[model samples]
Target: MRHRVSGSRLNMPHSQRVALMKNLARELFEHGTIVTTVTKAKELRPFVESIITRAKKATTITQELGTKSTGSPEAMELKSRNLALRREINRNFNDRKLVKKICDEVAVKYLTRNGGYTRIVKLGMRRGDASEMAVLQLVDSEEKKETK
Candidate 1:
């Protein structure tokens, strides 16, 4: 039956689902938060988190190897790995600037921690069709306040 179906389809075809996730992700990265239906937010969480994880991994790879001008085997390998990860991340979003922002800013913000990069807060229901709503946001801002 519905056993291994995985991920909510959200009543959209494959292409629409991909596009919706991409747009939602772009908005989330640009604004640090977004509001959407709870079901959509649930689907968006893992998709967005995976991108963040890739960005973080790429950053870690560069940091680990530093900027050695020498063509050392280890440094070269790490550089290639980092590039591949960046390319993988780049293919998902339409905005190159947004991708850079994610890799440079958002990823670095979460480097000290592991996973759980996003938070979802329930906001009751929409008045129209009575669909449940929620605010999906990055958790780093709260952490920033605490560090100050």
Candidate 2:
């Protein structure tokens, strides 16, 4: 009767699972890339994408909100949206700077694109645990460009 569970439990309790996800996401956002077990990457993919999607929405709203008066209702609405998203993101990320980075820079980069903000590349297995490993990372990176 495990149907429709929607996500891997990773054999962890709810709080540990949430902590693992938050830490993985924070590292991924701060470094723009991370290598972990394939199972974990698969799980983190959608989680990271949702955050990027939120960022994209903020970017779109800000772009469409240009020239509005700061005190105007429209401007206030946009500000509220920004604050709300920030607060939502802050739940996963303890550092305010990382949250700002995602909203201001990372999200803005993917504005033209629809989705697929993160990419996962299989990196073979870990020697000790024999777990299938992979690199889960942001798509747009200067280092990725240089490697190309």
Candidate 1: residue pairs that collide: none
How would you encode candidate 1's per-residue C-alpha lDDT over 1-148 as one tens digit per residue?
Answer: 7998889889989999999999999899999999999999999999999999999999999788786654898888999998898888889985678778888899998897788999999999899999999999999655668899
Backbone clashes counted, model 2: 0
When superposed on Cα atoms, how far off is each prediction in RMSD? Answer: 1.7, 2.3
- Best model per lDDT: 1
Q: After superposition, how far is residue 133 of candidate 1 from its true place, in Å?
A: 0.6
lDDT of the structure predicted as candidate 1: 0.90
Weakest lDDT window of 10 consecutive positions for candidate 2: 58-67
> lDDT per residue, candidate 2, 8-118, as tens digits?
999999999989999999999889999999999999999999998887787777776787877889888998897787778887886789888998999987887788889
What is the TM-score of each predicted model, taking all chains together? 0.92, 0.90
What's model 2's lDDT at 56? Answer: 78
